[model samples]
Target: MNLIKKSAIALCALAMVFTACSDDDNDDKNTLGDKEGILLVTFGSSFPDPQETFKNIDNAAKKRFAGETIKWGYTSDIIINKLRQGNGEGSLKGQIIDNDTPQEALEIMVKDGFSKFEVQSLHVIPGEEFDELKEAIHAFKEKYEGVSVKIGRPLLDSDADIKAVADILAVKFSEELKDGPVLLMGHGTPHAADAQYLKLQSELQKLNPNFFVGTVEGIGFDAGTTSIGGILAELDKLSPKATKVTITPLMSIAGDHANNDMNGNTGESELSEQSWKERLEGKGYTVNTVMKGLGDYNEINKIWMDHLEDAE
Candidate 1:
């Protein structure tokens, strides 16, 4: 009887040991982090490219500001646009909304107990949106009382920063591109876009004048389509049939303007930018638009890398 009892106790002990080992293995397999805490903030991503573009910024932040959690605070427009575009199942470009605003995003995070935020704007310039964001961030900080938040600078803070970005932009054009004119597609706004594009165009030309450089906006350029045609017309006048045009976007990360306005083909609206390539071809010039974003380039990635330091 004593031997049987001792054998039963030994069997129970073995079962308990096996159960503990199974639990340990299961914990290892499900190694994911908790989302209640992190660092960093931005407007919001409507599509994957802009989201991924910001992700590139986050990745840079990760490399330099290691040992910190990076959290994203996105506007309701991103959520709504994403959902209306079939629950974020489709491309992010379709995620833009007419009524989207920024203040509510920070409010959502604060309501959820976020105490600190490095509110960075992905806006290309310090124009209306950036100005509004700066004010909203300030209001949020003042209202929160115990929390901390700071607004980061725009992409057009200074020309050295522009050259830093332009030098980064320079790497994308190959040396073979020396014979081909490199045209950058920028969102020429009624406000600062022309000045910014002019600055970027000058910097790229300075970097390498072996290629001609020009920019046309989605709006604000005098005779919008004509500016592009004018550049091509001049190139045609100079080189005739030998013109090799490489068009790349000058915008912060080609979200909608790069993908839709520059590349879309059905010629949707008269207000839409007539295909620059089609226009150049009509003038007998060989046209090629480079469909890549500045954010993805290694050197372009350095822009955020340079800024993350100030983030500290």
Candidate 2:
């Protein structure tokens, strides 16, 4: 009887050893498993107000791409410097924002064992900034072997995107459109992609003739048609002569351009450099300014999210 008991005990020990070996193999497979990370790149702002929009975007991305490690990258060195300083008055007072550049964020992700990466740009157009981002992404790809990298296009990359954005804007400012014409201020670039603003303008006009799109830089390939002066000239040709106008920023964040350039006053004289608001008011048009950015709209954010999805 004692011999039989010893044999049963030895059999149980062998079974336990086999189960432990199987568990170790599975653990090793999981340790070297496929890992993915997402990097959201944008021309970041220095102000605190835009942080809310960023927060909303982060939340949306987290909800959509759950279980994936997410990170942020700011393209603007000036803004990043100011944020790091954290000693300026007003917006920058007592605020320390730590953000990584596109290259830095990707490096960190690679160090964390993420072999697959998806980069999403939050710019309104594929302008100079987006071009630079693409270059950076390309360099990153060349530097890392066996690492998969994909980048999403900007907000207005294709005809469908232009049409979709115009539709959303038309609906967003439906009430404002009823009151008067709406003038949107975009950040223009000398890049060939600047023509996107013109395309967007055409689409917006198709939806509503009162929609006018202009740029602050006024240095696009077709400057004559996309500049602020161009928009003012078109406004002059209005048959009924729009007496009231609603001015807003078409940028991702309503930063310096929206707050100061679009709505700020020089306060020196009417002859000095004038904001869009002042310029419109000079024409005897009652101007209503909306200090909201494109990022403030969930519908607009979804379009960006869709671009990321396509990239993935």
Candidate 3:
């Protein structure tokens, strides 16, 4: 071939190679390094499934931040106790449950070296606990010179959250038990939590007439209002011969509260596995603890799909 023609072909080949190299470099720049992100935060799980609460939160995040990278972190001590694995040999089994206190969780995340953060809490409301979580996030963001963080609200406890929860749990009630009583256990606060309980009670009643939904809190319900004796007294008044009743927790995850406080027995309780089965059998109504978290399936899913798409 002629020298001029050969030179022209060589120039074109060089141009193609340059273009390919530039594309590769751009791909690397876009997908790797500080450009990638992770969302770190968790909700307060009430045990056995402390790990599961993070699992629910992580599932939601993965859906919300599909293309973007996200690493779930816990904010609850209840969960840390059940932790079995982490970023180690059996890393695949390593869930997000952690042994870190509020401050320690942040340190671990910083040590892993992330740059951008979108913190989402599974809090029921932007109440005291939620506020504390927010403070923690802000502190972390400020403490870490280069980290970016944003907070998300609790799904179930939104203005319409109680309503949504009522709808979700109404499915647990049977038609035959339309007149039977239903009690929902929630981690109620001493303050605004009463409002949440009222809201859920109202919503559940509207959804299904069978359940007169009421809440028992670590703070609110005592033997007078929520004390086991008071509740049993009312149950006797309503249905002395009633053969069955259904109880469920209104929290996102049914961990310790559902298992222990709601079901546990020191004197007389039915549902807690640690307690006597006879206590439940003696109750006459036949106690059953609902094993699902509010964020169990569909509710958790909506958060994930919606958020991930928005993040994209």
What's the TM-score of every candidate structure?
0.70, 0.83, 0.66
Please write out the lDDT profile of model 2 over residues 1-312, one tens digit for every residue.
999999999999999999999987654333232579988888888776777778778877888889888899999988777766763225643322246789988877776777788999999998899989989988877676567888888999999999999999999999999988999999888788888888998999999999988888874334543666677788899888888999999998888788777898866575766888877888788999888888889999899989999993
Question: lDDT of each model, Cα atoms only?
Answer: 0.59, 0.83, 0.56
Task: Please write out the lDDT profile of model 3 over residues 1-312, one tens digit for every residue.
Answer: 699999999999999999999987654333222544555555544244545656766766676567766555556654455453321222224345445555565555555555565555555545667677777777765565555565666554454656665665666455435546666666656555446665666677687644543444432234212434444555666634556666666666766666666666545335333331233357766765566666665664465344434431
lDDT of 1 by residue, 144-261 (tens): 5656665566576678877877676677686546657777776555555347666666687688653443455433234322256556655665543456667776655655556665
Error of 1 at 236 (Å): 3.7
Which of the two candidates, 2 or 3, achieves a greater TM-score against the reference?
2
Q: What are the clashing pairs of model 2?
A: none
Stretches of model 1 off by over 4 angstroms after superposition: 1-51, 73-102, 210-226, 237-242, 268-273
Q: Ten-residue segment with the worst summed lDDT in candidate 1?
A: 29-38
Cα error of candidate 3 at position 245, Å: 0.8
Kindly indicate the candidate among 1 and 3 with the higher TM-score.
Answer: 1
Quick one: RMSD of model 3?
11.5
Candidate 1 has which clashing residue pairs, if any? 39-69, 39-71, 47-92
